[model samples]
Target: MSQSVHMSVLLDEVLTALGDIKDKLVVDGTFGAGGYTRAFLEHGARVIGFDRDARVKPYVDAVSAEFPDSFQWINRPFSEMAEGLADVGVEAVDAVVLDIGVSSMQLDEAERGFSFMRDGPLDMRMSIDGRSAADIVNEDSAEDIAHVIWLYGEERKSRGIAAAIVRRRAEQKFERTLDLAEVVERALGGRRGAPVHPATRTFQGLRIAVNDELGELERALEVSEAVIKTGGVLAVVTFHSLEDRIVKNFFAERCGKLPSGSRYAPEVKAANDPTYELVTHKAQGPSDAELARNPRSRSAKLRAGRRTAAATWSEQTVSGKPSTNKVRS
Candidate 1:
């Protein structure tokens, strides 16, 4: 595979949050293009990079050639980092950094079908396996499609867009990115000078639903708690509101920042000790200079926390309520 150019978002901020890493074992959970891994290796840290996309082999090979003794690649999702690391006789790491969402390389590759601007096969699977965006658009019911767009995309015209997709697919199955984009655009009244494309949310919803991106992030957050040693940092960079919310909530709950119940009820204390301390009280955004250099980093937000010596909580004890935002399979 040819090398694809990808600039890691908030590279400096993430490094600052991680502090010094000389001789530390760091895990680059989302090792897209090896951007963060390369930086970590260069700073005298042994890096274990994880990515599900097979196309990243070239970048992995390049990193391995440069730092053969300090770099290792795992062909798996970041959520499964615990198992992958255990397979190599590793237990915990000094730090874990996750750059969430689809990479720029995936969006630029027309064949990946991550962008509506470029026409190609309607496939958006990061792993290049399982269901694709075309499968969801062409096979799911109108109501199901609307739920995905509404819940994941946060689009208001989801029902109309889904209805339009179903109507178009009857005459011809949706097989291309531009075909679906056009259908959504027409359904939303041709954008009418909107700041962003009409199909952007719909595409985002489909991509998230196809890969269970939100679910994977939640799992990764939980696993990071177990795999990161005490005092190790867990830095997450989210690109959208949904992702940022999950990360924020996870940090709040883990840091013993839970909400009080009700005025009628007596005050209840946290069941378990805090597992992490907030590295930053608020999420960090890109600077003006960085924003001008990369417009795509505008929506990026970085939130991090350092693990404590407390015991890890069980999944059930961590949160009283189950997640309802997950897309139905």
Candidate 2:
């Protein structure tokens, strides 16, 4: 197969965390251009790769042809891996690795509508089904739109942006990426020489809400706990603070690092034995060499854990106090 142009961030660190996986089962939860899956196969590991984007089929075909016996591809979201794995007669895997958020392939293709830098249909659905970003902006109420932008994008001026969208849509509904991006940019009073684009956060919010990215990540993390064998690894590379926070909290909770209540409040104890031991005390970021090679990886953070022999926690006991502290970039 031809080489992939898409770069897998923190590839060396992820491989190191997984240790020796030769002949072991590993799930590449976000296959993308088959970068990680190819690496795993090269290491002599058997891989089950999952991706929701149909556009990745060509890459999948190439990897399958080369590693016919060792590679398998599932064209569903990684959150459904447990059910997908059961259908393939696999009970558990030795490790599960996820590269979260939108893939570079989607971002680069203007037609995918993932980037404000390029104009395209306002479609950001990862599965190519369900609600599109155009649908949200054109049909949702101003209040609802503001909430989505604020909650998912973390944009401080979400209200003004939402109001601008509503006012503009009243004249003509938004159908193109540039039309909406322009509105958001104007709403924010132009870039004002900011390093990042004015519409970055607004686009991010719409994309997350459209794709249900956070919900999918949460479900995948939970399912992974059940499908990994004892001593198995669960490694995730997050691109932003929101994604990193979820991963950090999940690892902390599973590793028995439950949050202690305030001095006036009672301390909480784990109802079940810890399910994992943290592979790293703190999250790992890209090395200086990697940053120089791929500046896009600057925000990437990798967190991993090794499964313990303890039984998986019940739903009631699985809840963890959401971390109030912001994740350091």
Candidate 3:
């Protein structure tokens, strides 16, 4: 497959992790290009896919025609999968697979403003509606922008970039992707020895904030816990550390593995039952062949788990709010 396309990252690992989904109902949480869903359908599983992007309808329509009664597409965010699926008489699914982060298609289409590589309108709304990147850069205070950059992108020079953005926007609002990118790059001292583009982190932070990606992932994990049947499987592929960390921590929490608090604190059993068992003890990375085939999959990590008979932790799935500005100490 051409690397230019949305080549499914860790497709083999995901299929292996899912074991046998034949004749089972599976949920593709992020059906960007329908890679995972198509694979599941070919494996004899009925698929219910979810995506906020309406542009994916044509691609999904073709797959739906092939599968006929075996496939269904829900044009909604994965966070609302539980409620949305319920409306269509899908109470639970046997497996849930999510491929997280900005899609290849979104990045390639400069009009979406997801990539800093090409100049485009500064509109990075995942759902095609809501607060945009331009809104944040133009309206939010420098402090707020810095907080988002530091929290989402883990950029050390977030303050400098935010300050520069505020200064530049005062003259003319950042209406284009290249305008913001250039400002951020200049703030970071023209890249110097940086491995990636200087504006990559800034663009990533803006995109995450504009789409509320972290919040969506956090809420979606809870929804997966609620909607997946006992013995069901959950396979997630995340592109970066921030996304991987959430999945790792969520799996740890659900498996009854308590975090090591201070030495002063004693270990106590969880009040609720453990809802998931570890499928892969640790996250799986793309293989050498996959790397050669698609360099973009370099940072991808796949983590999978199996649901237990224990009740869902409906009230307390995550530690705090979904869209947290929590800076890791």
Best by TM-score: 2
Query: Could you tell me which residue pairs clash in candidate 1?
Result: none
- Candidate 2: the clashing residue pairs are none
TM-score of each: 0.92, 0.93, 0.92
RMSD of 3: 6.0
In the range 213-322, model 2's lDDT, one tens digit per residue, is 99999999989988888889999999999999999988878887666647676546566678889987799999999999888899999999998876666533554422
Stretches of candidate 1 above 4 Å error?
1-4, 260-269, 315-329
Score each candidate by Cα lDDT: 0.89, 0.89, 0.87
Cα lDDT of candidate 1 equals 0.89
Task: Give the RMSD in angstroms, all C-alphas superposed, for model 2.
Answer: 5.5
What is the alpha-carbon lDDT for the whole of candidate 2? 0.89
Model 3's number of clashes is: 0
Residue 36, model 2, lDDT: 97
lDDT of 2 at 308: 82
TM-score for predicted model 2 compared with the true structure: 0.93
> Comparing 2 and 3 by lDDT, which wins?
2
